[model samples]
Target: MSRPKPNETSSGFESPRTDEPLFQPSSEVWYKDGNTILIAGDEGFRVYAGMLSEQSSVFADMLEIPLPAPQATHEGCPLVWISDSAVEMRYLLKSMLDPRYILKINQTLDLPALCSILRLSTKYNVVHIRRRAIEALQHYFPTTLSAYYNARERRRLSSGGVSTYFLLANTCREANANVLLPSILYSCSAQQLDTILDGVPDSHQGRVELSHKNKSAVIQSRHQLAHLARTGTLRWLYSGEGCSDKRCVAIRRRVGARLLEGRSIDGFVNPLSTFNDALVELIDGDCCEACQNAVERCVDNGREEVWKKVPSVFGLGSWDVLVKAYGQE
Candidate 1:
């Protein structure tokens, strides 16, 4: 079917008058013989109400509202006004109607497309798109350090680096995805201070900005991470019962020397990875079995302890509160 040219109103009346209002349709592709026209801002889209209603309870409810005298029409279809970003609505509509544009697990969506789907899907209560968006984000920012390391490594191998965690942070809030925030905020905190302000390309939603509270929280996380590097880690490594043994003492000395030489945690965004690296170094050294086991235990304990504090580090509530907010409870 050929695309419908822009008509000024729901009536589809072509007026030769100079006063004919400016009208924009989404694209040639979406202008199907679809029964309903969705007008977002100045851009109109011809699409199926039945398909939208099936996917979204919100749309079903909206469609249930009785239509009065209709002014705008395209190919005998009524034009419905949508108070949303035209770009976002376009993306959402495409994701629903176009098989090729549909979101999938293995396929990567650039930040703009992902953000649009997330924003509109959340607002319109489109569950599938929202789920896919959250899954894609989780792939980028997994909750556990091991998972995060695996995902981060995969991302690095495939696309390089993720510099849009800050943008994801806001989108998570918009989408009621608090579960993703702990990882998102941590990733954002890990970014270089300058880059945090500049933001990554394609993640900008209107303005690429962080809340003042979040900015301070990131700064605090850096400071706390530094403190953990200097004292907390070293203290944990040396304050051991096995230290009485000469072999254990030698192991501690070797690890401590490495730490002092800057196997430091100053640059680590996730404390678990930092601790894991330290454990690996200790294991490589000629440490006694007892000391090695003790160090490993310390790493496990420290990881749990740090994870519990992660939410607070980013100015959020305790873990329990955050998990409940994310509807995990």
Candidate 2:
């Protein structure tokens, strides 16, 4: 690793400055039999024209336009300047060159690699490459709450907690994945307020920042989630009051009150499980059979209602919209 070179000033103060090289050499592994060189930032990659042309029409069209005279050359090949990061270029080029260089899917991928493939592939007009990258990300950001939990749980079991949802959400917006916004917004609402503002860093993309629109959505969604938890619970408890067992009903109401006391659905790791457990414990000797059945039915109905309204609660459109948007993939 190169250390920062110290520069002495007239004020007798020494400051570190990075002396970046003018040009970076192409990697031997990537400099295989080639006809063109793609220079990204300071790095150079010598790759075949035919391969790039086959995968990307943009590259093909560019290759067809004959250059006047090459200002720069890498090992006798004409250099094509690209403003993209060298890391992204390498990833994009490697996938096009090597058949067995499998991009990760159905699992947690390095955020930068995932982002690079999605962004660059879309830019280069590589339809299949872009589609695969989009699909891999969609696995994490589903359209519905049930699908979200299922994917989240599967990921948790397989690889523990991955804090890439924020980045995934941002990437989806850039990729024009509006259908996934509701679930992604809900996930954001469940995060710490500080995380929503400061954002998080990943190995590949460095600090993945949230946009202003997403931040505003998060703030609004947080209030909506809390409101739903409070009012929805109360609504279910009072929906049916003509009960034979008054004491049992009173006890159930007390439990519901305690569970819903200034508490937001965001706080519950598994709201459905928590609600079910809280009510199930009351089915013992203390509560009568009639009250138990009533509580069971009430919880079931409340959960169904909540599931149906969860999208609207978070300022999202209906489930039909989410389903339709998901199908656009």
Candidate 3:
């Protein structure tokens, strides 16, 4: 696939002084082959289609050179390098001519951090050349990486959940929860939820939807599931975050306070889309405190603004209103 196209201007890089080397900046460019096009650094990172220019950018960093951000991106985005060598890395960080390139240092140069770039490519909406570059980076990791480098699965059978908490969630949901509850809550097939929920704490009331009750499991899981909610997965199982099930509800309840205020349903997310695609668009478009709170419930951790928005949006209203607004999906 062709690299993603970035808007370009003649002057790509910013100016320089005696201390800085004089390097000419080029606009984003692309070269097309029969059906495919490749974007090179000379043309910025832009391609015929939306492909990321990561390879060229990272390579430029590798060559002790810098690539200016094209006109297409937000100005605040940092201009970072990936050099691991202290001399090279330090010089590269200090050599940054663009003040806009904040974070002056490279975060990852080791195998693990470099490999994470692959995951970042998958997470961010980068495509084409950028995606290809990420795929190539994966080659840096050995086919048989060490235990940590290739720990593909977080919840292993050998180490899945807290024994006590697992028992609790099992017991809580199975007994009181409809055998059909997981399906209703997970947005997954009945069998999937059933299989997962089946690991209940021997004959507890039902799935331990409440957060406090399942503390052991969270500990056992090493917060991996919660991390999935925050970063790994986009499709949150429930109709929304809190309403997904008891565990989700408890997570939010436990967070205890609102981090952001106003109709700003701004919560923490890598892309921020997993939680509030609607919050930023809908709430930002226009939302009352109540609607904001209700929307705030989308966060998995159940932040304070979210709780406040929930009650304000629904709790303040009649039972029907509350049901419609805050009722579990």
Candidate 4:
């Protein structure tokens, strides 16, 4: 709509009267319909319908309200992110809490840089970014996410409406628990897991920390399972997706039968591995078992040193600790 016309104009237009009361300036641009602004000072040409002071307040410790858009070309649709000095406006736009802001951001950003902002948005409490970032991150970093499906960065991510959890889940379902469990356990809740345990029977490890009545029974179940695992009654073997279903209950019966199996209500995670290894697993570690099996053969051939040094091929430092703690684990 056009701005309201000024009354009693003999010349062109007179500025706000100097003697006017402090509260009643003759030409206040507090609202968006004020005719036009010349954009005083040397900031260049533009027309906005709000007070300059109001625009400055959006960045400074001054006013509390926002201004109408000021781009010369689009009028009200200001592309606040185009200029470096407009950083305040950029941040404010990033935090607008509206999903549509992404459309604007996407117009100006590449995928990786976009993902970074999406994550930043989540960290800054921008709700829409939590999900958008996950999708983009997983799409590009799928293997990393898969191996670390339960890792903190992926936890509650889907819950946050990111929906990219499936990307990680698809790739992580088959890895060895001993090798991949720590990454998954890093950020997930007790219930958010199980995809990682695929075929393994519930260890009494299911504590009822949050839900009391059921915690003890679950714990008992896990401890029994872990006991069987520890005693070799439950020989772990890979069968694709999760745990092997065939001899699972049989193992439970043979070993955990005498003792109630249970573990801490919370699932356990081991010490973490290298950043690259961890990221690789979380993204996609489906072939890890086969890879290790080959390495074992090399070690059995009296090539332990050769096998240990193999990690250096992937730019790793040492496997001494891995061999010492859970060799071939």
Candidate 5:
């Protein structure tokens, strides 16, 4: 492949940037017989024009434009300059050209790789790749509460916690994956206020901070969620008439007092999740069966209510709006 020197603008094409250093051919995606070279950032990828055109309508239209005689060529093929992140472009091109580059395993993927493919795929109009990337994200951050709980129980969800949520929120916004934002932002609200504001440390990207708008939303939602958890999800412990058993009534008062004091035994932001089996056992062991059943019903109802309000709490309108904006799949 012919290596383009620094600051050389190809004829009949506007270079994406003029100050970029010499373009380095990608060792992974460069093919000896490739018919076209794609320049992203300071990296060059030699790939078959036909393959790209076949998978992406954007590429198809761009490749169809005829160049003047003696057009700029890298090696013996056409040079196409693209304004995209080199790392992301490499991930997108590798996924398209290499059969062995698996995008997912058990519906889970590395966050950076998944985000890269999603961004470039959406930009380049690669429908299948974009769909797969969205599906992988949905596996971890589902729209419905039941799916969220199921993934949580299986431990198959992303383990990056608040950091991961911050990344997902930004990526989904850029990729126009609006449906995934509610769950992602809700997860972000579960973290400490300081952590959210200070940003999460990322090895490759440095400290990843939420946008100013997102930071404000997450902070407001955090306080609102904590309040709701006590007043709503665990309301049975405070306002409900316990069974005639004096002991059951006492247990309710004790737990409710502790919760009001911001002393959650489980330390979970989601009130519904905090009332796990262990907490249930603590209450049920002393209370009558009827009281036990009533507590469960209250928690379930509260969880549903909170789930319904999540999108609005984060300023994303409603689930109906989000689903319509980004079709559920």
Candidate 6:
């Protein structure tokens, strides 16, 4: 579709005259036959009104309202100004307009696109798009222990390092996808203390910080999980009951000493992941077969126990509650 020049108004109807500059129509989103032009920020998207109304109840009601006097027009289409970032609106519009944009089975959306689409879909009552976005998040931050381990092993979960957890946590709250919070917040608690408290820099939004309530929750959970890591999850290290082999006993003692001295290979914040690769290799490679089996059983049972406590650790109740609440939604 050909866009109008800056100073040129569309053919038939007079434009809303103002000293403020007109929005630049989005090249990617503009449709020649579209009847409505939705302006978000300084960008205008010419899209079919009927299509939008069919997908979003909020848009349906908004478009039905009569525009008084001279209506705003963009490229001869009726214009409506929306209070959302242009980038976010573009993501939402594409997801709604293109059947393959969001629903593709093999597609992996980056964090920003996922959050933006989820937020707008939730706000506009676009159920399918919102559900798809939430499913993507669940793939990364799953509710079950086995599923989480599977995702981690397959390298499907992207933490985006420590900073991204803060962004994801806030987005989950905004979209009301609270079921993803336990794993997301656990990732937040895994970061360094100062990093958690000071927040992290985001490319688009300067710095992102958790809400005060969540900040406290993660910090407290960090301490609690660290304690559990030593006393509960990794207690096998210090339990002094390995196999009869002297070498295996020595390896266990060395690893236990390191953990006691606060020099653990996996760090101490995440109890559920305390048996990381380094520790796993130490137990599996050098230890006697009986000792290896013992450690495996302990690690499995301990990680599951810690995983079950995760939601409660962050004041989110339990897995059953979260599952029920999300189902009701």
Candidates in order: C-alpha RMSD to true structure: 5.8, 6.7, 23.6, 19.3, 4.5, 4.9
- Candidate 5 structure quality by residue, lDDT tens digits, 1-329: 23345333555444333244447888888999999998887688999999999999999999989965546566787777787878889989987887667444224456667777888889889888888787787777788988877766432344554566687778787787888888888877776667887998877678888878778888878767777776678878776544767787777777666656664333445654647653566465577777777777778888988888889988899988888777744
Better of 1 and 6 by lDDT: 6
Candidates sorted on lDDT, descending: 6, 5, 1, 2, 4, 3
Work out the TM-score per prediction: 0.68, 0.72, 0.16, 0.22, 0.80, 0.84
- The lDDT per prediction is 0.66, 0.64, 0.29, 0.31, 0.75, 0.77
Worst 10 residues of 3 by lDDT: 182-191
lDDT per residue for candidate 3 within 1-329, as digits (tens), equals: 22233333467653222233221122222222211121222122212121223323433333344345441121232222221322222222221222332222132233222223323323332233223322233233111213212332321222223333233233323332222111112111111233343443423234323243233332323223333333323232333432444444444333322212211222322212224554454345444444345555444334322222222221132323433432232
Candidate 2 residues 48-151, lDDT tens each? 88888988999999877876432345567776767787888887777677665544532455544666777788788887877777666567655554566567
168-262 per-residue lDDT for model 1 (tens digits) = 66777667677777767777776766666665554334346555655666767877765554444345555854457777677677766665665
lDDT of 6 by residue, 28-113 (tens): 79888889999888889999999999989999999999976467665677888888989999999998887777675126676667
Which regions of candidate 6 deviate over 4 angstroms?
A: 1-21, 153-160, 243-250, 260-268, 274-288
Consecutive 10-residue window with the lowest summed lDDT within model 4? 175-184
Give stretches of model 3 more than 4 Å off.
1-108, 112-274, 300-329
Total backbone clashes of candidate 5, pairs 3 or more residues apart or in separate chains: 0
Which ten contiguous residues of candidate 6 have the minimum total lDDT? 1-10
Clashes of 2: 0
Q: What clash pairs does model 2 have?
A: none
Positional deviation of residue 117's Cα in model 5 after best superposition, in angstroms: 1.6
Model 1 regions lying over 4 Å from their true place: 1-31, 39-44, 57-73, 78-87, 98-112, 155-162, 197-207, 225-234, 237-270, 274-293, 318-329
Question: Model 3 scores what on Cα lDDT?
Answer: 0.29
Candidate 2 residue spans exceeding 4 A from truth = 1-31, 41-43, 61-70, 106-112, 157-163, 201-207, 231-235, 241-246, 261-277, 280-285, 288-316, 322-329
The CA lDDT at 177 in model 4 is 12
Off by over 4 Å in 5: 1-5, 8-24, 60-73, 81-83, 98-108, 153-161, 262-269, 277-281
